[model samples]
Target: MAKNPDIKAIITTDKDLVINSGVPVFLSKNLEHLQVLCESLERILDASSHEINDETVIIVAR
Candidate 1:
C-alpha cells in the first residue's frame, strides 16, 4: 500500500484487514461486510484479556 503524509504506515493482512497507523484507517475492500468483519474480530479479541499485539491498535474512522 502507498504511504500517506498524514499516516505513518499501512498494513495489509491475509484476512483482508487493512490497518493504518498514526491516523486511524480501516480499508476492508474484500470483506463481506465492514460491521460483520469488525464484530468478528472483536469477539476474538474479547476472548483474551492480555494485549495481542502492542503495536496494533484498532480504530474506527467515522
Candidate 2:
C-alpha cells in the first residue's frame, strides 16, 4: 500500500488511552493521490484499532 502526503495524523485509542498513532506519506498523481490518501487513513485506523480485553473498557469525553 502507498502512503499519503496530505494526512497529518492517525489516532487510535482503547479504554480511554491512546494505543497508536501514525503519519503516512506518498507521491502520486491526482486521482491516485486522493485514493492513496483515503487508503492511508483507512490503513492507519485499521492498524491502530485493536480488540479490547475483558478488563478493558473504552471511554470518551465530549
Candidate 3:
C-alpha cells in the first residue's frame, strides 16, 4: 500500500489486539513523511475521548 500514491494510510493490529501496535511499529519505517502519519493519528486519539455519539463510527481494518 505504501507503494500506491492513492493510499494515504494503513492500519494494522496484532492477533491479540492487546495494544495499538501500529502506532509504534509504523514509526520504524523511517520514512519522514510516513512517520508523520503515525504521529498525527496518535495526536488525534490523544485529543479525543471514547465517548462517541450515535452518529460516530470507528473502523479498524487490517
Candidate 4:
C-alpha cells in the first residue's frame, strides 16, 4: 500500500543491462565508484543502500 519507503534508486557497475522500472538507475565505472555513488545518492535521496552483489546496489527509504 506504500511505495514511499520502497526502492528509490539503483546503482550498478554493469553497463550491459538494467531493469525497466521507474526507479532511477546510476551506472558506475567500478566497485569503488559504485560505493562512492551509493554514498552520495543515499544522502541526496535520503535513503539507505543495499548491495545486491559486488556489481549492484539498491536504494530504499526504509
Candidate 5:
C-alpha cells in the first residue's frame, strides 16, 4: 500500500473563479466583447428556453 496518494487540490481567493482543463477560454477586456457574448448567450438561451427554468451560472474563463 502507498503511504501517500497522489491528489490535486485547488484553492483560490479570486472573486472571479475558473477552472482550466485544456478547454478553450474566452476573455473579455472591454464592453464590446461582453456585448457580443451577451448577444450570443441570449440567442442560445432563447433557443434553449425550455431547458432553463432556474437561475444559472455561466462561466466563461478561468
Candidate 6:
C-alpha cells in the first residue's frame, strides 16, 4: 500500500517568520547553512526537500 505524502519538517533562516506547529523546525545560521541542512536532512530523514522561498525550505515524506 502507498502512503500519502506528508510534511515532515521545515527549515528556515528566520525562525521568527515561521509559526509554531506540529512540524519540527530547524533554524540555520544563514542561507548557505539552510541549504546544507536541508540537503542533509532530506537524506537523513528519507524525505524530499522543497524551497518555499529564498529563506525557507520544507521537507516532505514521499
Tell me, what's the RMSD of every candidate? 12.4, 15.1, 12.6, 2.4, 12.3, 2.6
Number of backbone collisions per candidate = 0, 0, 0, 0, 0, 0
- The global C-alpha lDDT for each of the candidates, from Candidate 1 onward, is 0.37, 0.36, 0.34, 0.86, 0.35, 0.90
| Model 4 ranges with Cα > 4 A deviation | 1-5
For candidate 3, write residues 1-62 as lDDT tens digits: 37512222343322232244343333223345444554575466443212122222122222
Q: In angstroms, what RMSD does candidate 2 have relative to the true structure?
A: 15.1
TM-score for each predicted model, relative to the true structure: 0.30, 0.26, 0.26, 0.82, 0.32, 0.85
Model 2 scores a TM of 0.26
Best by lDDT: 6
Writing each residue's lDDT as its tens digit, candidate 5 over 19-57 gives 573432334444455445545654643421111112222
Root-mean-square deviation of Cα positions for candidate 5 versus the true structure, in angstroms? 12.3
Between prediction 2 and prediction 5, the one with superior TM-score is: 5
User: Worst lDDT window (10 residues) for model 1?
Assistant: 47-56
Off by over 4 Å in 1: 1-26, 30-32, 47-62
Cα shift from native, residue 50, model 2 (Å): 22
Off by over 4 Å in 6: 1-5
Candidate 3 clashing pairs, residues 3+ apart or interchain: none
Residue 54 of candidate 5: its Cα lDDT? Answer: 22
Top candidate when judged by TM-score against the true structure: 6
